[model samples]
Target chain A: MLRAAGDWTTASIGDAERAIANVVRQARGVKQLNIAGLGQLDTNGAMLLLETAELAGEGQAVALTGVRDEHRRLLEVIAAASVRHTDAPDDGNPVLRVLAEVGETALKLAREGVELLSFSGAATMAIVGLALRPWRIRWRGLVTQLQATGLNALPIVGLLNFLIGVVLAYQSANQLSKFGAELLTVDSVGVGVLRELGVLITAIIVAGRSGSAFTAQIGSMRVNQEIDAMQTIGLDPIEVLCAPRIMALMITLPLLVFFADVMAILGGAVASMFALDITLTQFAKQLQAAVSINHFWVGIVKAPVMAVMIATIGCFHGLKVSSNAASVGQRTTQSVVQSVFFVIAVDAIFSIFFLIIDV
Target chain B: MTSDIPASTHPLAIHVRGLRTQFGSHVVHDDLELAVRRGEVLGIVGGSGTGKSVLLRTIIGLNRPAAGEIEVLGHLTGTGGAAAAKAIRRRWGVLFQDGALFSSLTVAENVEAPLREHSNLSPRLRREVAELKVALVGLPPDANDKYPAELSGGMRKRAGIARALALDPDILFLDEPTAGLDPIGASNFDLLIADLQKSLGLTVVMITHDLDSLYAICDRVAVLIDKKTRIDTIPELMKINHPWIQEYFGGPRGRAAIASAERAGAAV
Candidate 1:
């Protein structure tokens, strides 16, 4: 195979085929005909080769060469694979066509992934620059965002956690009654609230809410070249931009998680009071007794880790934003998905580490 | 001592020598040398992507130059991360091509952006400074309360200029100051610049393609070519036989220059 150079110009298949036919006609005694230096082929070249080869009456043959990667891939597109029969023009393999389309789709996906990776790399460089200078926080921006992310997120987090506890208490009671182990329901409610639901729900919420918001905010800045402006004004975009968000989330998320856990347990207590006629005093005692410090800390630790992951991933995606409206959506969605995925992955890693340590 | 000016005349506003900025394989500026005196207007005219913006950006540390020495307002040239540039930012102001005022803020708040960022001045002071600029630019008092979206094209451009002038900078850089404005509005901006230069002793550097603008107010002009300052002096530009420059100031654009010269001759 002859390698196509950068300046290679594509020829139509018909033209190449005509050239091939002329070459074949000229060289009457040659056994094997190889065409090279045509560089890359379009359909006009490919089809001409197929047709001319099919029509070789006596002792002439030609094999097409010098197909570039893209040319070969396009030929694999089923249009010029050469027909099975001259009798039926319509009876080409349908599966091959479908497979070609699938291949093209896969290529598109690969291209998009590469594009995203490059963008992420650019932002990573900018963030690294900011990280080198730690004291560049825009305090007002930080305060405003913190109030929005933390103080404003409180009521929803509180109510959601409280209700989650109620569900856990009621559900555990339902299963326990069959085995006459209703007391175990208290342990289940306590464990679930303190050790799992609280952290998971808060992470999901933060991932959904704050993650997208960060992406939008930074994405808009990214689009506006405000991030570039920051750089120009002797400010590290990441330190003035990313570090604050990351720090705020780290500080706030744990508190939110702790609140969510307490509220969920309270929810469970309320359900216990209604279902089992257990007094708030008795419910509180059972919750405290059933939940070990280990269990509480397990979920509590996940909060800060999850928070860091969320804020970092969100800011990372935001900084990756391109100079348009579409990249804003793309980065915001990517940020949310990536943050949630990272939070879950980190949570699992921590859970296993804790288990390995016998914590 | 240069032949154009006496030995005692020192250009205090900006002194740039051998400024070269390259991005990857593209050299945006190469060996660009320019000096604009205090209380002078230097209009830089170049087509799009010719490093007009890059030159202004490099001087103020918005874009990093690969090799150069730029002294603006008695400070060394620093790139996007230059601390010296930050310290000198209050003394220099820039009006972007698109105004580029923060969309979230009202006109008054937008004008106060630099002041608010760099100063510990109270709200009242910021407000007073904002009001002064607004009035100086001839924007109505009510224009301050309106968002950027509420303003027309000329209004936005004026607001942007007002913001640039908020700190009463020693050197002001404007990128396409009157681009997309009506003829009358453009002339109005030019007259305003002339008035400001006279009253404030302000040194102005404007990047524009408008011939009327250059003739109307600019004390001198620098022409950029191939992303570099091809001709630093206007007479040197006349002697140079570059196609675009000749076409720009000779073929069609020469009419304006000839007319302006005739007007000067008639006045004499």
Candidate 2:
């Protein structure tokens, strides 16, 4: 028995070509060239082995020794159309063969599932840790969120609220003036700004800005493999990277909400000053009187909760994204839309509960 | 070019028996046995899927062997005592294929990690030691403060070498150390290795396909074929009559080494 010994490598294209050349030149003198010990041979390597045998003039078979199942399979594939390495002795064991095939399939499924779970779990843990930490002074993750979602977010949030306020004031003013009921415009504007429109418009604006931004940043980091790299270096990707950002947004979002309310009110106040023939001060007083501190504080409280929720969700999805660059863009968009939807849904629930409690 | 323990006159460093490593149902390293002596360079050459990396990982205790006895440097590995396994690792240096330097840490910190983790050296002394090792690898002392990303590929590899030598390990493992380096860089690195081994009396185990390296650095080599490593000294390996050898040494690299040895014989 030939005691199999030594290393192996897959022959390269050049190696295969050379083998073919060697066989062509010496085919007449050889019986079978015993093939063994080449690992990771490519298609070119297979082709060369095949060509070598085919060109081996006549009456020659390349006897393959130490043929690993993979090698034998590859040889069979290459030799399907060409003649080479013809003699592969099979020590048949169906059970072993079935085990190998089934085991590979199971391993693949398990590996993929574990990787998916790893992504989701790691991302969720990072975001939850960030959101739950008390990094803001006002417990005002809400207030800061108002800022990011609403304050530094002002120009965009303000711009959007301005359009909404303008549209509301214009349409309502035109309809009321038709009946010479112009004075009732103050009542319409005051109640509308207080009960729902102001907070609703502002919250939507905040969601689009802060929520989406969070996702993009985290998603890109995921794409770059920085998270995995962090794990390898014994650094907590959440503590070192995500928490501070989440904390910053918490600080930013409530202030964002406060700014959004201002812009939205300004939009309504401007229309009141003009359309209702009420002075800015009178409009302000009327607006303030109509919506109690309860209404304002209620909306205000939702800012931080909303911020935490949006930031958490954004970071979670971003971190959960796949390694590919395309995943970042896709997840970022999803994060923005999902955050906006969740924020509105949560806000509505809170509003209904608070109103019910007050009533 | 330099003497590291008077050529290959070192004691045995690694011993293994009945080693087997499997991935799922596929057995990669089966009933493998090999021993490597200290104070000599042992080269490992293998075909793909022959479990070369698997064998190395098992011997180093990074991956557990399905069935085997591994005694590295007089210590049985894979026992429940993590401290002992870690101490064994602390006494050995490994340079992975891509250097595997911490990207976040400066070169100095990466080198200092093992020292900080295992040694009792003060911070100042550790920094000094790191600088010295960096300089020994022919890197500038300033290279220590630069992140792994700042350095070129060759520089990173050198930095990895510097870090590996930080603990003054008795055994050094280099996996594809010259895989991506230019010929000049690779040759210089080889010379650096020779000098370091000679001066430190280090036992080096290098895995490579570079035939020139086999002739240049290896005192012995093992062919990982047939699911186990069959090691032979360079002189004995040169005369090996096997199918793998027919394709390997019979190829350019093996041929070149033989021709060079003949030339040296003529010169002698």
Candidate 3:
């Protein structure tokens, strides 16, 4: 027999748990719980008492003696409400868990690949349909997206490429001067900036900025049931929302890349004037001789493809959002990651193609 | 052993005096005063934009009043030191409308959060307590492992109630507990609240617009009027001769609720 005294309520349970545990340990296999001395009893306290009885009685319900009229019902209720203990889900082996995680991740990636393919197909169909009937297109939304994704992105893209060009010119001029070829810095800066760095950097920046924005905007709309409302109203969300954003990005990205190329070469000229004591005319002459127009076109050609990849990735993840704010946050993060990853991968592919074809 | 701990000498669970709440140039409450008795369900009702939630938020120290003396469980809310405030806070639980369960946690983990934060109970014990709380709130056993997003509207509110009751608090504050529930679900929730209050001997302060809930479970109703409050029993409040009060209880919906409650009372 064990004496259950003192307040069993939440107000005192924090202090009483240790004492109760001690008693339960000492009273192992005890079959009777005496509660005549019990103070105020609430749900927490009753739960504690019931747990104590079960523990003391070796996982069996124990009888209560001296149960007062007031406390009897509470004790009975709590006992009936005791949660049936179930084994926690088997996390058993660390090595197996890690293997499972790897498999899950690979599966998720494959599923994402398939999803992206289907999304691209649908978007292409929408674009082709719109192209066939230009009057059916939403010109206002396309123009707005153009202004947002393109015009608004100009300053940052231009400034970043310009800075990259300055750094490239300074660093290359220093390296080339070691070989008594300081004039060749213009070639490295022009070819490298135009063919790779300028477009690559612009794509990355746009992926982080506009790509993430697309995901968050559309994902939140999905969460708010705005997408469902549009569908119910006989409007296709893909045609109405995704198509405009994609077209705008496709139109803007090349312009942005071209603008970036010009700004970077101009920056290289400025840097050459400072670093190599060469005038703008001399630098421009060297650039004209060093880089073919094909290098600029090579970079420009990658922009539209990268834009489609980024915008489609963004819109795909956005449309995948389930009905919650947390999913919106998660899908937005995924959109950014996938877009940036694809952008770099496509850039690598373009580089390889150019290499094979001897551009 | 627990009897030696210091108890609040005051009879009231909450006491507010001269509470002045405002947002910039707009005044919400002016010198509003309220006192909630121990072990009673007090319902706060008001018209739209009448600052009912603001008042509840102020009493719980979420909103800082422009000027007031707000005491909850004998501790001055904002004026008290952190330790004192936290102590008082632990003694009460507030359930916001829309369940507001942490989307990240499963239902059981959501209930265990307060226990984890405030108590030194063992992990097994905490889980047991959480499970019991969930069961007590009438949630299904499977709901313990399910995330809040998976639960339906009514189930989400029940999960919220389970979290609120996890601490076995002396006072429970519910903000529109039955707002979005269907009529049957709302009344069932009211009955569940009334049952919990009776069993736990809790002091409940509820903010609601549901006249049926007010009629069904409220011990007394506090009507927010003219930027202040008029506190009285429902029948007494009905006799106040004020226009808003008259229109409120005498309104068609209110009359229907009263009639339904009368029928329920007669059946009982």
TM-score of chain B of 3: 0.97
Query: Per-residue lDDT of B147-209 in model 1, one digit per residue for the tens?
Result: 987999888888888988887777788888888988889889888888987888889999998
Give the per-residue lDDT digits (tens) of candidate 3, residues A1-359: 88888788899999878977987888898889999998899998888888888889997778989999999898888878889889988888999999999999999989989988999999999999999989868787799889989999999999999999999999999899999999999999999998999899999999998999889888877775456434322246798789999999999999999999999988998999998999999988888998999999999999999999999999999999987899988988999998999999999999999999999
Highest DockQ among the candidates is held by which one?
Answer: 1
lDDT per residue (tens digit) for residues A25-122 in model 1: 65445333344444555565555544444454344444445554666665566354666565656746899989988999999769866765665465
lDDT winner between candidates 1 and 3: 3
Which predicted model would earn the best TM-score? 1
lDDT score, candidate 3, position B200 = 95
Worst window of 10 by summed lDDT in candidate 1 chain A: A1-10
Give DockQ per model, in order: 0.20, 0.06, 0.01
RMSD of each: 12.5, 13.7, 24.1
True-structure lDDT of candidate 2: 0.70
State how far residue A161 of model 1 sits from its true place (Å).
4.6
Q: Which of the predicted structures, 1 or 3, would earn the higher DockQ when compared with the native? A: 1
Better of 2 and 3 by TM-score: 2
| Candidate 1 error regions (>4 Å) | A1-140, A154-178, A227-244, A266-283, A320-322, B1-9, B73-75, B79-83, B104-106, B116-123, B145-150, B232-239, B250-268
Model 1 CA RMSD to the hidden true structure, in angstroms: 12.5
Stretches > 4 Å off in candidate 2? A1-359, B1-12, B15-19, B57-71, B74-78, B81-89, B113-123, B238-241, B261-268
